[model samples]
Target chain A: TQLLEQSPQFLSIQEGENLTVYCNSSSVFSSLQWYRQEPGEGPVLLVTVVTGGEVKKLKRLTFQFGDARKDSSLHITAAQPGDTGLYLCAGAGSSYKLIFGSGTRLLVRP
Target chain B: SQTIHQWPATLVQPVGSPLSLECTVEGTSNPNLYWYRQAAGRGLQLLFYSVGIGQISSEVPQNLSASRPQDRQFILSSKKLLLSDSGFYLCASDPGGEKLFFGSGTQLSVL
Candidate 1:
């Protein structure tokens, strides 16, 4: 199994603060996807990084794929109250299955 | 545009009861389908997937089983339900690319 471990399982920060959530794995992945999930709802895809060392920006959110494709990161700058939710990173293995990280719950206080 | 639909947004059933959850995709053909279960405070666990009709692949060997009788429909069923089966069930599809489009999801509660 391609295990993706995300750090800081939970995070609480005041509005305008910056934070980074890390997803690491020992096995290389062909692609990695980041998602944000709200309570009582399915996850919504945020970004997909296919190439190594690729960085994509979605508004205030920045996502980076590791050079080795074994890790990824999600950074939120000047976070707002609307940013609170559960963030998950999924790595695609050789098969069709996606190995999901444990997830990180973040709360941005306004 | 394409859309995925999962039936019975919320279900409450007793233990040892039969279970059936249906998912269908519209405006697309021959897409990869996936069934995932999400426990509270955790990530998604892939239960089953299908590349085409009657081509189900079980990611985990357990009580739950999935079937794809048609090209655009996937069904998850079990003869007897377990308390551990209570969780959120999600269905997704990806025609191409690594990204998947998800359905609204089904919340099943086994008592």
Candidate 2:
């Protein structure tokens, strides 16, 4: 079974702080996706990185795929109170299944 | 674009009771449906997936069983509930095999 490991399982930061969450995997994936989920709701896709070393930016959030497609990272710049949520990384291989990371819980203080 | 609909936003059931969770998809035909369970503040564990009608794939063997009666409908069932079954259940659809569109999710508590 494929597994994705996430770092800094829980994060607490003040508004305007910058944070980076890492997702590492021993298995190579064809594509990687990042999602943010609010409490009591399912996760919403943030971005998908397909190419190695590719970086995609969505406002203050930036996502990067590893050079080997075995890892990924999500960087948030100047996080706001609204950014407080659970961030998840999911990687898809040749199969239709997506293996998910343990997730990062971000708490951005106002 | 595809949308997923999951029912029973929250449920509380006693042990040994029957369990049923329904999920349906809209705006897409022959989409891949998936059922996942998540622990508190953790990642999602894929329980079952269906690629077509009457085709169900089990990822983790547990007390859960899934069935796809229609092209857009998926159901998760358990004959006897367990306390360990309590968690947040999410229903998702993969329309393009790229990204997943998730429903609002259901919270199931087995006491």
Candidate 3:
């Protein structure tokens, strides 16, 4: 079974602070995706990285895929209260099934 | 672009009662559909997936069952509900490549 482990399961920071969340796995994936979920709602796709060592930016968020495709990271620059939500990383392997990480809950106090 | 629609935003049922959750997709045809269960503020556990009509794949063995009655419709059912079955159920669709589009989710409470 493939599993994705996320670091810093919970984070609380002041507005304007920078934070990074990490997702790691031993198995390689064909693609990785980042999602942000608000309470009582479904997760929204943030970005998808298909190539190794790839970096994509969306507004204040930067997503990076590891060189081996076994890990990914999300960095938030100057996070705001609006950025507080549960962040999840999902990896798609040969089976086309997405294996999701445990998720990191961010609380940005204004 | 694909959109997933799930019904009954919240459900409260007894342990021995039956269950049925419906999901439909729009803006795409013959899309890959999936059913996932999530704990409170946690990750997603894939329960079933269907690649085409009348095709279903189960990732785990439990009291739940899934079916695809139409090209864009997926249904999850159970003869009896369990306390462990209480969770947030989400319906998702894959528009070919692997990126998923998810529904608002249904919170099932089996009391």
DockQ scores for all predicted structures: 0.74, 0.94, 0.83
TM-score of each: 0.97, 0.99, 0.98
Of 2 and 3, the candidate ranking higher by DockQ? 2
Clash pairs (backbone) in predicted model 3:
none
Residues B1-111 of candidate 2 have per-residue lDDT tens digits of 678899999999999999999999999998889999999999999999998999999998899899999999999999999999999999999988878999999999999
Q: Order the candidates by DockQ, highest first.
A: 2, 3, 1
Q: Please give me the total number of clashing residue pairs in predicted model 3.
A: 0
Which order, best to worst by lDDT?
2, 3, 1
Q: After superposition, how far is residue B11 of candidate 3 from its true place, in Å?
A: 0.5
Best by DockQ: 2
Interface RMSD of each: 1.1, 0.4, 0.7
> TM-score-based ranking, best first?
2, 3, 1
Q: Which 10 consecutive positions of candidate 1 chain A have the poorest summed lDDT? A: A91-100
Q: Please tell me what DockQ candidate 2 reaches.
A: 0.94
Query: Could you give me the TM-score of model 2 versus the true structure?
Result: 0.99
Candidate 3: regions farther than 4 A off:
none
Compared to the true structure, candidate 1 yields what TM-score?
A: 0.97
